[model samples]
Target: MDTHSRSFAKALSWRATGTIDTMIISLVITGSIKLAAAIGATEVVTKSLLYYLHERAWLKIPYGRKTAS
Candidate 1:
């Protein structure tokens, strides 16, 4: 498993990207800045937790991972 900080940073970066994308999509579909921002805010928190857990889980599985020299 990777260090908590590494996983957290990765999650934060991924969540930032995902939140931007979500905001764009939500804005286009909903045509409401407030609604879009709300959706983005929700995704930022929920997806960050999900992404961190997902990364941790993947780190535990050794399949297809190469060992460092």
Candidate 2:
């Protein structure tokens, strides 16, 4: 099983990549750096929490995992 800290770290790293993508898309559509940054900032918090929860939940599932006899 993955540790809580490890899950948290993974969430953060994943969020960093997602945030950048969101900001780029926001900037392209809105043509405003400030707006893009605001969108990215909010996404960072909300999505990070969501991702962490999702990761933890997946750890409880028994699908596709190998076990030693």
Candidate 3:
């Protein structure tokens, strides 16, 4: 079953991958380590929260969730 802790862990793991991706793209565009770091750091927080909220919202909808047998 999905739980808050599971959702939180998923958010953190996904944010790690996403932050690195943003950092790489930001570095490519800005050519500045400082700027890339700043952008990545900001997104890490923002997107993680966004994702957690989204997950909780989806959990309530019961659209595609499967029941345990």
Candidate 4:
């Protein structure tokens, strides 16, 4: 495969593994908290990006949280 394709494949594999791990962790945490379903990769990535921007002061308004302070 080409370099870009290889890189993308590697990223995909890594993301898949991370998703699985996140799912398992989410399952445990949610079970403890009595939450419903385990969040997926999309949600985790989106939340992380939002938090990064928030920490950078780029996102002043809360994106996912119930209250924005």
Query: Evaluated with TM-score, which candidate comes out highest?
Result: 2
Give the clashing pairs for model 2. Answer: none
Off by over 4 Å in 3: none
User: Which of the two, 1 or 4, has more TM-score?
Assistant: 1
RMSD of 3: 1.2
Per-residue C-alpha lDDT of model 4 across residues 1-69, encoded as one tens digit per residue = 135445445555665676667777877767642232346646556655554444445234456656546
Clashes of 3: 0
**lDDT for model 2, on a 0 to 1 scale?**
0.98
Instruction: Flag the better candidate by lDDT, 1 or 2.
Output: 2
Instruction: Judging by TM-score, tell me the better candidate of 2 and 3.
Output: 2
Displacement of residue 19 (Cα, Å) in model 4 is 0.6
- Lowest summed lDDT across 10 adjacent residues in model 1 is found at 59-68
Writing each residue's lDDT as its tens digit, candidate 3 over 22-65 gives 99999999999999999999999999999999988888897877
State every prediction's TM-score relative to the real structure.
0.90, 0.96, 0.92, 0.47
Arranged by TM-score with the best first, the candidates are: 2, 3, 1, 4
The prediction achieving the highest lDDT against the true structure is 2
Q: After the best TM-score superposition of candidate 2, give how far the Cα of residue 17 lies from its true spot, in angstroms.
A: 0.6
Give the runs in model 1 whose Cα sits over 4 Å from its true position: none
